[model samples]
Target: MTLTEEFDQSLLPGELILLESAKLFGATNISPNAKQWEYTRKFPIDELRQAIQRGFGSIELPQIFGGPGFSFGTKMRIAEELSKFDLAFTFALIQHHNALVRVAELSPSDHSRELIASMLTGDLIGCTAMSEPEAGSDFSSLKTVAKKVAGGWILNGKKGWITNATDANVCLTYAQTDTSLGSKGIACFVVLGDKEGFIRQAGYELHGAHAAGVGGYGLVDYFVPDALVLYAPGLAFKTALQGVNRARIHVTAMNAGMLESSLSIATQYGENRRAFGKSILEFQGLAWSLANVATSLEAMRSLAYRGARQIMRGEDALDSAAIAKKFGNEQTLSGVAACMQAMGANGLRAEYPLARHLAAAKLLSYTDGTVEMMNERISGAVKKRYVL
Candidate 1:
């Protein structure tokens, strides 16, 4: 049996089904063209439609919202399984889910509810635009402003490094509503892509996750009616922070998937390729390297699942999520790199996915939160609780 098959057999029924769905979707639609799509930096809309048709887009939301009502942990496992085959495609879907979850949680307006209904049906694509060029790690200093108008607000600013920027039908955007209040001044809004002054610029030439359509846009006097305002200044920053802290666990799952795939590829290559009159797997140094990576991958999985479980139990997981995010990113980068080195030059070739995995590992480090941000979260807690 294949390695994936062996792994699936060990899972529970629901998890087995999720893994099977991801495997089927990847084998039939995504895995074959991942390289071509990456080279062209073009997302596969047709494949995405297929994914939606299969109901993968609405995994964790409630059935009332057209979702399958899966638990957070189940959804995270599905994310891990899907990303193992195609990280870019999986990343795009994750971005869609992010917008849906955040909007569902923070938006209390009638219009936001209608948009959520549309998103659940897969008729609308949603994305979050939270990071700006100048306000990445320090979001309190974001230059994007939302000024009150006669009947609504005029948003004037630019957001960079947004996933699904060019093609999403709606955006969950944040802006400074009261600059004098610093972090408390920030507020979230629901901005429709077709509205006047909402302009989508060209996508970025990213080293990895090309199919994710990560790009920037300029909102030149974009008009947002009061009905579209999700959270006001006093509550917006807290909502966004909590949403991101939860989302970090999903990011950890994606990285774990990548590390799993990288290890599988490296193991197969080492066992088959011969050097010094024997398979590379027979060498003590190479075998020990693989052992170390495998250990790290398991540890990452444990941490990610623990964080998910904590969230499912209605507990605060800020510190757990931060630890998982930081360790997962660092370890995945190191483990994937080690796997590539174990395979020698063949791993660096386009024919193999090690090069792609390496690029993605680097990209994952910055998304959601930077390694520095994660460090701050964890260290702040440590100092508060343990310092004399």
Candidate 2:
């Protein structure tokens, strides 16, 4: 069997089906011409539509809600496989779960059922609005306000660096319902993209993950119905932290997959290219560097797998997830850079995956949280073990 197949069989029966769905999605979305697409930032939307049509977006909700209701292990596995090709595509599609889960958390059973059904069938492309112009990482200090009105709440603030911002039909926004409560006063609301007082704009030029179509949105005192309120004040912070931690794990896996791609390219180059009348693989310097890259790749993958398993086991994986993100992103950038060096000028050229992978890995180091943030989280956890 293929490597993917072997990995699939290692998972539970439910996980196998999700993996199948992901494999099908990957086959349709990931281009053999990935370099061309990366350079151009023009993805094949029809392929995305095809995957969604096959129910790729709604595999996590329960059957009672018309969702496949796959386990966390399955979700992680599916993300790993899909991100192996292109993280941008995965980012664009996973919004369904993020949005629907929030709906389930804040809304009643009937609303959850209806929203989840729509989420799976491509009718509800959703996004989270947490990062404002001033509150990218420090969500507690956000100035966005949600004030009570006659039939709904009025929203006023700007959201920056949002993924799937333009494409999403709905956005689950977080705004401070009461400034008196500080972070504890924050609350979540469901805002339609075309709602009154909502203004959308393009974001600044991003380096990598450009295909994700990130943008900015301005809520010029937008109004959402009282029915649209998601989680109340106290719950917003809890869910934001949880979602970010979960996203960190996925970022770890994406880095792992990108590192593997880079190493594969480097090894193939070493085996085929020759210098000084000998193959590069036979040269001690190139061989040793390749060895280091391979070792680092395995180590990062090991860490990410542990984090994924922790998520699978239904345990709190925040600290472990942060560690995995820290190590995986650092290792991926270093490994890809080394691979580029091994390839000489060819690696620098756009024809190679090394350049694109290196860029992508660098960007990932800061996406969910920076390496510095991960270090802080890990250090704090360590301090809890004993007085230092």
Task: Provide TM-scores for the models.
Answer: 0.93, 0.91
lDDT of 2 by residue, 264-370 (tens): 87889878998899898898988899899888877776676677677767889989999999998888888989898888888888666567777778878877888
- Give per-residue lDDT, candidate 1, residue 225: 88
Record all residue pairs in model 1 with backbone atoms less than 3 Å apart, i.e. clashing: none
The C-alpha local distance difference test score for the whole of candidate 1 amounts to: 0.83
lDDT of 1 by residue, 1-388 (tens): 6333443454567656765787788767877888888888887766776776676776777776667666777667777877777777888887887678666764466776788887766678888888998878887788999999998899999999898886887898899988789999998888888888998988888787888888878899999988788788878889888878777898898899889999999999999999999999999999999999999888888788778878888999999999999999999999999999999988988777778878888888998899999999999999989995
Error of 2 at 371 (Å): 1.2
What lDDT does the true structure give each of the candidates? 0.83, 0.75
At residue 376, give the lDDT of candidate 1: 94
Q: What is the alpha-carbon RMSD of candidate 1 to the true structure?
A: 2.8
Q: How close is candidate 1 to the true structure, as a TM-score?
A: 0.93
